[model samples]
Target: MKAQLIEGGSFQDSRGSISFVNDFCFKDIVRFYILENSEENKIRAWQGHKLDCKNFYCLVGSFRVSYVKIDNWDKPSKALKVESVILRASKSQILSIPAGYANAIESLEANSKLISFSTLPLDEVKDDDVRYNKDMWLLQ
Candidate 1:
């Protein structure tokens, strides 16, 4: 069980965007997740995994990624909205995420595909991936 954390700064080499790759301890049983951002899951809570690590690559357009520390499980931490950046795959930039932090990407374009990969395969409702109400986290 190996845990890793890779941020956009290290992976994204684009002048205005970001991307990266990460290889964890998992030799097999990796899970691939394709997320299409819509109005429903616009605002939410994401917690880092215990055993799984992630890699994010921008197939098109750009996004604004943010993170927060988990002081209270119910309360949303500070809103650390990163600078809005563009990730053009033509430049070959990718974002890699390790297992320690929570992250969310808001699409800058109307229709964009942010390809993300993870090593641990599990359901979204599992203990590894936890999401809370954005508004709910603030009050806690």
Candidate 2:
């Protein structure tokens, strides 16, 4: 499956505002984690799961999420296409990345925080986790 952006919206009332992604379903999510970068342009690169999927949401500031479909688990091709999307807290949306892909994320603003929802439980992650060099596939 390919990457998809599940768009969401916000509602502002006299008291405050509410942001939501009404179409997002948590049925398959087994775990979740938050990613915060200390500085802008800092990247967390090239981590993948062969059997697990991931969903990302920006909680604070903005981010650039880059991903690539893996051609081979052992050694992916250097020419693999890289796709990216920018997520901002102002825009309530979720970036869904399906299994069999590698992804990297970069903070576009200082102290940006991103939440990641995973389909695999912590105990089963080790077996499915895969990592590659940061420079393996250049981001466009």
Candidate 3:
């Protein structure tokens, strides 16, 4: 029900000379994914996992990520709280999203990219993901 930002720096990984830290203490890594946003100021919202958690690392360009707390299943759109952050390479940070929280991502630059690590595998995550209208939480 919360979002965490962890500071990271350059390190060696299978991806080569990337500004990443190969460490995860929160949860086991079930999968990794890279997402691309081809246009600037574009929004992608929203999705939430009932059991899977997520970690986000910026690989290219920049974007804004928003997390809204969904306290219970009774009202998925009723967020107990909302938090947002800007992600960019210069910041060298990673975002941790807990399960039960809905998230929205917006690209601030064209071709923005991000690497995400999840606690659940593909098939399991697909079914657990809950979707909503893009402007679902815009008014609030």
Model 3 lDDT tens row, 31-139: 8988887555478788888888888877888978888877665566454566888889666888899888888888778888988889988888778888877776862
Pairs that collide in candidate 3 are none
Q: TM-score for all predictions?
A: 0.58, 0.97, 0.82
- Give residue 5's lDDT in candidate 1 (0 to 100): 38
**Better by lDDT, candidate 3 or 1:** 3
> Per-residue lDDT for 58-125 in model 2, tens only?
99999999999999999799999999999999999999999999999999988889999999999999
Off by over 4 Å in 3: 10-18, 77-79
Residue 55 shift from truth in candidate 2, angstroms: 0.1
TM-score-best of 1 and 2? 2
lDDT of 1: 0.52
TM-score of predicted model 1?
0.58
Compared with the true structure, all predictions reach lDDT values of 0.52, 0.94, 0.78
Q: Where does model 2 exceed 4 Å of error? A: none
Candidate 1 C-alpha error for residue 83, in Å: 8.4
Question: What's every prediction's RMSD, in angstroms?
Answer: 7.0, 1.1, 3.8
User: Which structure among the candidates has the greatest TM-score?
Assistant: 2
Q: Give me candidate 3's TM-score against the actual structure.
A: 0.82
